[model samples]
Target: MIRHLVLFKLNDGVGRDEPRVIAGAQAFRELDGLVPELEFWECGWNITDRPIAYDFAINSAVADGDALTRYIEHPAHQAAAGQWREFATWVIADYEF
Candidate 1:
C-alpha cells in the first residue's frame, strides 16, 4: 500500500475561519467517499499550538503507486488543493507500506 500524508500551513495573515479555508477543508473531508482509489482517509486541524506544528493534515492510503497517482490526479483532489494554493503552503510525503 502507499501511504500519503500532507501537512498544510496557512500563509501569513490567513486564518482558519476564512470561507475559503473552510471550503477547502470541507472538500478534503468529502473526498474519502468521492475517490475510488482511497483505501483509507483522515484529515483535520492540528489541536496543538506548538510552533513546529502544521495547521492541518491529511492521512490517506491507496492500493499502490498507481492508485496513489490516480488519487493525486483526480479532478476533485485538484480542485480541493487549488483552494489552498491562494492561502496556504503544504508539504507531502508518500511511502510504501
Candidate 2:
C-alpha cells in the first residue's frame, strides 16, 4: 500500500476559524467518502502552537501508485485542493508499506 501524507500551512494572516479555511478543511474531510481509491483517510487541524508545526495534516492510504493517482485525480480531491490553495500551501509525501 501507499501511504500518502500531507502537511498544510495556512498563509500568513489566515486563521483556522475563518469560514473559507473551515470550508476547505471540511472539503478534505469529506474525501474519504467521495474517493473510492482511498483505503484509509484521516485529516485534522493541528492543536500545537509550535512554530514548526503545520496548521493541518492528512494521512491516507491506497493500494498502489495507480490508486494514489486516481485519488489525486478524483473530482472531490481536486475541488478540496483548489479550495485549500486559496489560503494554504502544502507539502506531501508518498511511500510504500
Candidate 3:
C-alpha cells in the first residue's frame, strides 16, 4: 500500500478559525467517502502551538501508486485541494508499505 501524508500551513494572515479555513478543513474531512481509491483516511487540524508544526495534516493510504493517482485526480479531492489553495500551502510525502 502507499501511505500518503501531507502537512498544511495556513497562509500568512490567515487564521484557522476563519470560515474559509474551517470549510477547507471540512472538505478534507469529507474525502473518505467521496474517493473510492482511499483504503484509509485520517485528517484534522493540528493542536500543537509550536511554530514548526503545520496547521493541519492528512494521513491516508491506498492500494498502490495507481490508486494514489486516482485519489489525487478524483473530483472531490481536486475541489477540496482547490479550496485549500486559497488559504494554505502544503507538503506531501508518499511511501509504500
* Top of the candidates by lDDT: 1
Q: What TM-score do all the candidates reach, one by one? A: 0.98, 0.98, 0.97
Candidate 2 residue pairs that clash: none
Positional deviation of 60 in candidate 1, in angstroms? 0.1
Error of 3 at 51 (Å): 1.4
Across 13-93, the per-residue lDDT of candidate 3 in tens digits comes to 999889999899999999977899999999988877997999899999999999998999999999999999999999999
lDDT of 1: 0.96
Q: Which portions of model 1 show Cα errors greater than 4 Å?
A: none
Candidate 3 residue pairs in backbone clash: none
Please report, in order, the local distance difference test score of every candidate based on alpha carbons: 0.96, 0.95, 0.94
For 3-96, candidate 2 gives per-residue lDDT tens digits of 9999999999999999999999999999977899999999998998998999999999999999999999998999999999999999999999
Per-residue error (Å), model 3, residue 86: 0.4
Q: What is the C-alpha RMSD of each candidate to the true structure, in Å?
A: 0.5, 0.5, 0.6
Give the per-residue Cα lDDT of candidate 3 at 3.
Answer: 97
Model 2 scores a TM of 0.98
- The list of candidate 2 runs beyond 4 A from truth reads none
